[model samples]
Target: MRKTSLDVTAARVSPALPRRIPRLPGRFPRRLPVRQVLCLLPLALVAVVAVQHWTVLTEGFGKLGTGEWPWLLAAATTTCLAWVAAAVTRQGAVVERMPVFRLLATQFAAGAANHLLPTGLGASAVNLRFMTVCGIPLARSSAALALYILAEAISRVTLLIALLLAFPSALRLSTLLPEGAVGPLLLAVAVATVVAAAVLLLVRRLRTAAVSFLRTALGEARSVHTRPARALALWGGSLAFPALQAAGLVAVGQALGLQIPAAHMAVAYLAATVAVALVPTPGGLGSVEAALIVTLVAAGGDAAVATAVVLTYRIITVWLPLLPGALTLGVLVRLKVI
Candidate 1:
């Protein structure tokens, strides 16, 4: 109640003084949040897969050594470029511009996830999470994912059609698909259509959700298309992804002495990938190998050599990148970048 000049000064300075933090006497610093650690789950899973496939990786690399080094190098380069394409496509999916390095890193990490989970579920999940972490709402993020998927699929099919038109005699159905495959494929498509219709008719909640999602996704797509730069990035990246992938396969074919023309190999690759698109395997695994080999053979490649080429190509494009990609994913998760 009767404070002097000294007391007033001390009281004023006390409020501004920093509180001392307790120092733990140990080399270890702080504990990480459990939620953040959970984000690193993919890294562990990828590591496990790597361990299980160690022999395959070694053999694939050894096979690469016997091929034309220049072509192999080209294949590797194309594989790397494919990641860049994926990053670009992801950016095109959303209106907001993401950090360049983190976007690139996420795409790289998503590569590992692609192999771990069936189809593209893993990569898609990683991207959705990344978008949410970057402050994008769940619904918008989902719509962006849909837009990316649609654009990529459209671009891939369009490229295939263009290639087929440009090179009339390059790919033949008899060479690639089994005679009865068309009938079964048609039946499967019909079944899928019917099932989708039935689901929409019977499941009221699902139907409402589907309609709402479609509206949101379409709106987002339209917004994205309105921006010329975004549209360009979306379509450009989409086209480049498939093109680079085919280029990698072609390079591998040349390296392994496959007697297919470059254009033919690209056509075969695109066709095979499209055919195997519906397969539920993780990264298309056995399905991809079978399709690629059969298609390559139809393109006039020796079956034995084509097998080697496909194997080498997958190793270079998928397996080799998994570890480093996983590492990048872990780093990003740890730093809360995603």
Candidate 2:
């Protein structure tokens, strides 16, 4: 039999695409120039502010050096536990099972990216890339990240509500304003609304989406309705992550010899965290510091003590992670992993 040209062409076509175009692995999409520049602005501002406030930061570090060793150690321990909690949440969401050690490494790398990248694209990029490495499709990874963000928002709001209920006076205490009579109250309401909306949307998405779709796109959602107990367990683990983070902040205050109570610390931390999260700043650098110090003072701390404690907390939580994150980025590049 004579071979037809159409028959030869049909055999050459790939399963991955419609026609016989050569299949090349795709590259990550380039960020738009305008967005990239906007992201860099916050990082730039962070550098400028840190440089301008070097003297104060130096003093804060000096105070940190004088902090009680046990308390400082405890702060680190609690923060480590927070990371463990985060990893547990992530593990429950992922599709394929990987070694725990590898997952932890990716988690560290993601944390580093969130701290070091100008726009924290590091976390998003790292998470997506890591998911790709685990054989998940891009859309599914994206959905997983969206779910993670929703989980975080819910947990943070829960903590915020707990703090507000415990310390009603904190409503009048934020240093985060033009000193308007109702500015803090308005901000609180705004934050609360955002948190509620985020949680509701996530819950609804998981509930309404078909099981097959959620299984592939956001696998954790499959359990959300069918297996409520597992879903709650995952949510509980995620909540523990941020709760431990707040605990770390409280320990930092105690470590610095600040006579702040844990309740006051929680309220101040929640308020400052919410305010700083609002800022466009990467990692909420200077904005976080400013909000934290002011909120701490409003929560009845001395200005100097509040400043010192928040500064130390940032050092441990922010700067300390940057070096490792930078190094991890380098390692990833060398491995051609990202």
Candidate 3:
């Protein structure tokens, strides 16, 4: 297939940004250059997060001042380190060893990008671009992305199950259930899965592409697992990323005096996130807060306190990182580091 302009532009690996920009004839430097816009878009979207949550940000600052300082500090610390965990997992996704600092930077930038784009499209695009800039082939880069996602999903579910089993009796799991809702919900989910599977199998082109993509992804997964260090990093980082996120939530819960056990809080966090994982909101924005608050309240926390905990957790994790992460993203793009 002939390469499109984007393919050609992306193929050029250089220290400077790719010249995919179009110049207007007799232009006065084109008031807003494409490159500037490209870099600014992520920043703008990220800044919108803070703007939308200005009340929460202000309230959160006041809470942090009055709330338990140590726990809030711990929450902030874990949130920052989640990016490092993500970077490690990204490294493990492919056989090639990316520059550590750049990879770390990319993950941080990806976080900012993830805020506005639904279902993680922003982060995925940024990471895919970074892989291409690092000279990885498009197919391999795609496979690597698939592997990272697969690992993350598996690890999250695994951790959730483990935690639930360990504290099953204490978690008041029944409170969250709408009495007979489980059976119907399960049936609905199963029906949807069946429908999706049927569609994939019935459509020849879709089936063929799906099979090919699976083959590539599986081959990449096998390759990654063969290296012990890589395998450890992949699985370890995947587990750590969500675990840290849950820990951050737990710390916030403690800081806000949420009347729930730490183990129960962790279980609630994981359960809420897993339940809303498929919701097509950016970083599970609205869905996550609603689900988490519900889960915490079901797990014996006061409703108002649960609301406070969830909002504060998001303020610390998402809002706090937006600006710096956006700056990092802009810098990475300006340096052609993707």
Candidate 4:
């Protein structure tokens, strides 16, 4: 069939019309920035947790009404100081001085991040980014992070041991494990170590990375120790961090009228924390609550009182500051401080 000029023109242009016409900017909404979304995610999660735990949280807050106000206030103060101790330890890990205000803010944000990420990954990531932005090299920043972690672990263990020795009768070591569990536990650890070693030996890249990391970590550790002030800050802050945390628990216990001795409560806090250290939950959430309750009960606290104290402590240290910490994290991210 013969086609009109208009028909021919329409046919020629129709296919290309869709392609030629630009997409209207207003037709589709722009996706939110990844950074903003990420910043909001933790806050959203915090809100979820608060909602889910509303009953427990309300009960915890209610318990505070009957608590010794002074002791509860002291607990809150100690919890706040734990963040300062963390910042000090971060400073001690590197030779270069970080901006004090930023460093402190980063630590505060890190505490919030800790709740969102597993095994303290959030805090580590934040601090590492902060250090890198402050002009520290990546390797050194990683090494500094390692040093901080090692120092913190050692200090926690050391404090635990000291408390145990000082109060031998406080925590019953024998009751912590079943009669025959130790042998199997040790065997399992040995097997795991051997397997890990074999895997590293078989993987050249993994071995190389491990060796390099160890060398850098060792070198950084030595360098940090050379400066007496840095060494003091690192070790002292590490020591104080866990001590203050345990003290906060103790203070909470006292406020809540937990009948357990303060020393026993301190030991319970350390032991419970150490037991659940490898659980990999964010800020040891569920694991921490369970361990604290169990350990406190084992340490001769009344179960009801122990639960109340733990709830109050978590409310004070974790939930209460959560929103503020999340806001601080958002601010730091916006500012590119972390």
Candidate 5:
């Protein structure tokens, strides 16, 4: 009886025991959590504006006409082209070999994520995941991203220098305020704030580990530096693509019946856009609209025209992208790609 009971007990417990799960043959996957460190004020700003200027938003939408459509298309096309160039530029630094289609999808998904989410977390997450999925080790992935970012900065600074040289008046902050000593002080404050923020970003090593990782993957940092000329050329091309985009915005303004100068629009658009980027808002919604309108007005545009031009531009460049971007993000989540 005892032997029989032992056998039955063993059988019952053995059948219920959990099996040993096979371990994945890799370093543990790292999750990049999306943190909304910035953009906390955008919601409140949007709400305040909604309550204060509901009439304008409504009226602005009504003014949207067929004539303005082509400019929107131009803006969208140039923006897409800029992104494509950026992705292609990044391809040289990535350690993992991925198909061009995969790279394109990753770029599209990253852009979608960046626009829809706060603080660029979505795009960053997407980028990391794409690198990981393509069999690049996490460290190398980070390094590749770093190199790509450095290239991007070189390009952006070049574009900014060109704009400043082309339109020195656009850099004048005194025009925005009453011409007192206070104007210079305010201008100094603005310049200092921008410089401080940029320094912080550029100095944050963790934010740009991708380049180091790429260096490691290549066996040495010197190996990565060997193609400096090619890298510079790629970066220059990226810069020009975005300059074309700035031109596209001017075209959009013209389409809206606003006779804005291209050089002035480029400078104002870059400044206002940079200010909006600092707001940390998803798509930089209210802050962007306000900055663009104010900048345009300061650049010799009538308030009504500025309002109309900005609204139409935002509709095409910002809101129009949100829905599709959100949908793409959802698809990425489903596919476990990001």
Candidate 6:
């Protein structure tokens, strides 16, 4: 009777052992959620970029000790203020009032994202997500984004034009380009515009979308500008954003003892930024550096000093904030704030 009872106990437990074993394999093979993976991707890309640019970043830091500390401190201050300017502009773009603290944090994260993705996509994506979460409709959020971008670009270009006018000798446009290059460049731009327009006209779906987007964007722009405070914040912040960026570059130039006049340095910074705006590089990383070095040299700065200045400026504005920004982005994502 004892042996029979023992046999029954073994039989009952044996079946449950196989079920538990199967669950172990299932746990080992479990996959991460797609949303989680996507959320983490930007941080991963930023890490890869940092590794790739590690040597340049180290060299940039090496020159920092020799730089004028006061100017570098000013540059750092200006960089922080630029983020505030961006947050203000973002708030002005949409009618809904975002929580000020959250808005600023989003902009900080957006800046980090901007360096990870090309052509400002990361920043745009983060802002769109944030706005959507803040209860804005998708179309209106998108339209607001477009308006913000348009305002920023227009303000930057207007500032550049005004600066060029104020200091006429700051940039010699004719000498900056090769002989006979202007006409061809203009013609090519016109032809490309025509081609793009034709393609838009030929595609019915794209044409409809474009028209809808433009109408929505115009409506949003009108609504945002109807309020005096919003209008002022929108345009004023936009104007100050680029000015601060250029000022940072100037401060860096001063720190490195670059002989370029402050006004000329500002012009060079603006021109290089505008020229490389279409390069599609992440935060205009490599391209901006090259363009800055070349433009500064053209503006009568020594090539070696210009290179060092650009590197130092980028390190202060980009590298220092990168890790913090990435961490903010991750926290925001986990919290569903963006």
Ranking by TM-score: 6, 4, 3, 1, 2, 5
Off by over 4 Å in 3: 1-31
Which residue runs of candidate 5 sit more than 4 Å off their true CA positions? Answer: 1-61, 170-172, 177-225, 228-234
Q: Candidate 3: worst 10 consecutive residues by lDDT?
A: 10-19
Clash pairs, model 1 backbone? none
189-299 in candidate 2: lDDT tens per residue?
A: 899999976776778765565445556655556644356554654687778877888888899999887777788788788777766665565666677788888888877
On residues 1-338, what C-alpha lDDT tens digit does candidate 6 reach at each position? 36797799999898878564346555566788766876687678888999999998899999887899999999999999999999999999988899999999999999999998897898999999999999999999999999899899999899889988999888666657999999999999999999999999999999999999999999999999899888988999999999999999999999999998999999999999889888998998999999998888888888899999999999999999988898898888888898
Per-residue alpha-carbon lDDT of candidate 5 for residues 125-177, written as tens digits (9 for 90 to 100) = 78878888878777777667766666665666667678878787764566555
TM-score of 6: 0.91
Name the regions of candidate 4 deviating beyond 4 angstroms: 1-25
Q: Name the top lDDT candidate.
A: 6
Task: List the candidate 6 regions with Cα displacement exceeding 4 Å.
Answer: 1-28
lDDT (0 to 1) per candidate: 0.88, 0.70, 0.89, 0.91, 0.66, 0.92
| Candidate 3 lDDT score relative to the true structure | 0.89
lDDT of 4 by residue, 1-338 (tens): 99999999999998877667677989988889988886787789888777877887899888878889999999999999999999999999999999999999999999988987796898999999999999999999999999999899999999889988998888665767888999999999899999999999999999999999999999998898999999999999999999999999999999989999999999999999988888999888888999999889888889999999998999899888889999999888887787
| Candidate 1: tens digits of C-alpha lDDT, residues 212-281 | 9999999899899999999999999999999999999999988888888999999999999998998998
Tens-digit lDDT string for candidate 3 (120-206): 788999999999999999988999998999899999999999988889854676777878999999999999999999999999999
Candidate 5, 230: how far from true, in Å? 6.2
10 residues in a row with least lDDT, candidate 6: 18-27
Cα lDDT for residue 216, model 2? 62
Provide the clashing-pair count of each candidate structure: 0, 0, 0, 0, 8, 0
